[model samples]
Target: MSGVDAFPGKGKVAHCDKEKFDLKKELARVTRERDILKKALGYFAKQKE
Candidate 1:
């Protein structure tokens, strides 16, 4: 049993592998973006008051 097999019909083998290869980088980038977005939202909220 492998990661791809664990979930069926999600994608082709190459596509799945591509995502897995970049999963860590993608995760870090997304996490950073989320934090930046939260801070931006907080700033806007404060400014509205």
Candidate 2:
């Protein structure tokens, strides 16, 4: 039997070869922004004490 047919669930696999890299970059940028915002909020709260 051929390689494709050897794998039973191959037909169900979804391909996103083009957008995969962009998605990872976007996720990293969002995470960094969130961390920076949290630190700023903490600094402001401490100043009010």
Candidate 3:
């Protein structure tokens, strides 16, 4: 009924799903790096005190 359905066997939707997955993976990686940096900063701050 919509524009995507009219295209039949086209793979456009799959491409969108892959893009979404990539974004989620990138977000997770950034969060992990941020947590690691935070812990390192805390350790250094304690050493300075």
Q: Indicate which candidate wins on TM-score.
A: 3
TM-score of 2: 0.63
lDDT per residue (tens digit) for residues 1-49 in model 1: 9986887874567877788879978999999999999999999999999
Assess every candidate by TM-score: 0.58, 0.63, 0.72
Better model by TM-score: candidate 1 vs candidate 2: 2
lDDT of 3 by residue, 1-49 (tens): 9987887865556888889999999999999999999999999999999
TM-score, cand. 1: 0.58
Clash pairs, model 2 backbone:
none
Instruction: Specify the highest-lDDT model's number.
Output: 3
lDDT ranking from best candidate downward: 3, 1, 2
- Candidate 2, overall lDDT? 0.84
Off by over 4 Å in 3: 1-13
Q: What is the lDDT of residue 8 in candidate 3?
A: 84
